[model samples]
Target: MKIGEIAKAAGVSTSRIRFYEREGIIPAAERGANGYRNYPADLIALLRFIEQAQHLGFTLREISEVETGVGEHIVSCTDALAMLAKKRDTITALIAEAQDRKRRIEALMAELEANRPAPRAAG
Candidate 1:
């Protein structure tokens, strides 16, 4: 399919797909005789996995490592789960910190709004 079709199917923009290709996150697309880019159907699944993993705090490099099996090997499910658990804990901590910061900002904004001077009466 064409780039537009792929972007529509993946629910992302054409620029993002192009960026992913340029970033080496995915393999280069095959070129047709007409000089058009032809991508594999399986690329959709890979793109979805990349997006979902990123939502869970995985970096592009980390996603690439897992997808390519290039990092330190995990010998068992336990080892895999241990790594996942660690990431989950880190995500939780970051969420808590973000919430605390949001509360502090809201409090400051409320105070500032409360101190705002009233508008003068119309002449």
Candidate 2:
């Protein structure tokens, strides 16, 4: 497949695909005789995996590490699990902080509501 075809199949823009290639997130495409990029069909699956990992809050660096490890056959299930656990803990902390801020805002709103001026009596 070509870059456009791969991008369409991966649900990403052509520029994004190119950027991923430049960033080493995915392997570079083979160049055809006409100088056009030719990507393997498997590239689409790899791109989708990258998209999913990003959605799951994995940074590019983290994704790169995993990709490199997988490519080298050095990454184990336990290593992946550890990375996930760290991410989960970070997200949990962020959620707690957000909830605390929400509670504070609600409290301020209640205070403002209580102190609001009453209606004036008719003359």
Candidate 3:
């Protein structure tokens, strides 16, 4: 398949595919005699996986690191799950920190309000 064909099938832009290739997130496409990139048909599935992973908060670096028989995106569901769990843990911690900060801010606001002085009467 051509770059545009795969991009259309993957619901991503052609430049995104090119960017992935450049970033080593996906294998580089083979160039044809006419100088057009010829991508493997299986690449569409990989592209979709990449998009879904990004949507689920997986970084490109993380996705690229998934090891398979071919060395990327085939042999390791466990690795992907581990990455998901790690991301979930990070997000959970951030949420807890944010809640703590909010509680402290609210308490400070109440204390300041309670200590505020009465307004002076108009002259």
Candidate 4:
């Protein structure tokens, strides 16, 4: 597939595809005799995975680690599981912090409402 075709199929921009190539998130494409870039069909799925991982709060460097590991046979299942567990713990902490902030805000709102001044009567 061509870059544009893969980008559209992956629901990302062609520029993003090029950037991914530059960033080593995706492998470089093969060039045809006519100088057009020919990408593998599997790149579409890879790009989508990148997008989904980003949505799930995974950094490019983190995503790259997993991608590189898969390609190199370096990261074992135990390693992958540990990485996921760490990320989950971070997210859980963030959720707890956000919930705490929400509770504080709600408490402040209630205090303000209770302490509101009485309305002035008309003359």
Candidate 5:
């Protein structure tokens, strides 16, 4: 598939694909007639994975490192799993904290409502 087609199918722009190519995550595109870029069909999946990883809080530099196995494989599958577990735990903790906060706020609101002056009926 061509770059534009891939971008449209991926719901991304051509410049984004070019940027990813420049970043070395996606493989370089093959140039066709008149300097048009021809990307492999499989790249669409790779690009979507990149998007998903970014959404999961993986930095581009980190993703690049993970992709290239750079600096002696600092990130392993086990390590990634651990990190994800920790993130999940943190999210769960935050939910609990939010629930507590919500309870306090609700209680405070109820107290205020109970203490408020009642409306006076018109004569």
Candidate 6:
């Protein structure tokens, strides 16, 4: 397919597809005689995978690791799992920190409420 067709089918802009090719998130496309990009049909699936990974909070670097693994057969399930476990731990810590912050804010609100000043009598 042409770049425009693939971009439309993949629900991404053509520039984004170009960016992915440049970033090595997707394999470089073959150039036609007119210098237009020619992408494979399977490119849509890869784009979807990237979009889903991003939605799951994976960084572009992390997505690039998976992309490179799929493209080059360099990463094993064991390696991927180890990475996922580390990400999970990081996310867990962040959640805990957010909860702590929320609790502190709630406590401060309660204290402020309890110590509210009495209203003066109307003149």
Candidate of highest lDDT: 3
lDDT value for model 2: 0.85
Q: Which stretches of candidate 4 lie over 4 Å from their true place?
A: 8-13, 41-45, 67-76
Query: What are the lDDT figures for the candidates, one per model?
Result: 0.76, 0.85, 0.86, 0.84, 0.77, 0.82
TM-score, model 3 to reference: 0.87
**Model 6, stretches more than 4 Å misplaced?**
67-83
TM-scores for candidates 1 onward, in order = 0.61, 0.76, 0.87, 0.74, 0.59, 0.78
Model 1 lDDT per residue over 55-102, tens place: 877788877766333223312457557657888999899999999999
Q: Which residue pairs clash within candidate 2?
A: none
Per-residue lDDT tens digits of candidate 2, residues 1-96?
Answer: 999999999899999999999998888999999999999887776787678779999998888887333332334678768988999999999999
Query: Model 3: per-residue lDDT, tens digit, 1-123?
Result: 998899998899999999999988888889999999999888877888888889988788877877634434654688767878999999899999999999999999999999999999999
Q: What would you estimate as the lDDT of candidate 1?
A: 0.76
Model 6, range 11-105, lDDT digits (tens) per residue? 98899888988988888999999998899887787787677667878888888876333342345678667877888899999999999999999
Across 61-96, the per-residue lDDT of candidate 4 in tens digits comes to 998888333342334678657877989999999999
Clashing pairs in 5: none
Ranking by lDDT: 3, 2, 4, 6, 5, 1
Question: Candidate 5 lDDT, tens digit per residue, 9-110?
Answer: 777889989999898877799998879899877676667766776898767875675532333333468866776787678778989999999999999999
Q: What is the alpha-carbon lDDT for the whole of candidate 6? A: 0.82
Instruction: Give the count of colliding residue pairs in each prediction.
Output: 0, 0, 0, 0, 0, 0
TM-score of 4: 0.74
Error of model 6, residue 115, in angstroms: 1.9
- Superposed by TM-score, candidate 1 places the C-alpha of residue 19 at a distance from the truth, in angstroms, of 0.8
Sorted on TM-score, highest at the top, how do the candidates line up? 3, 6, 2, 4, 1, 5
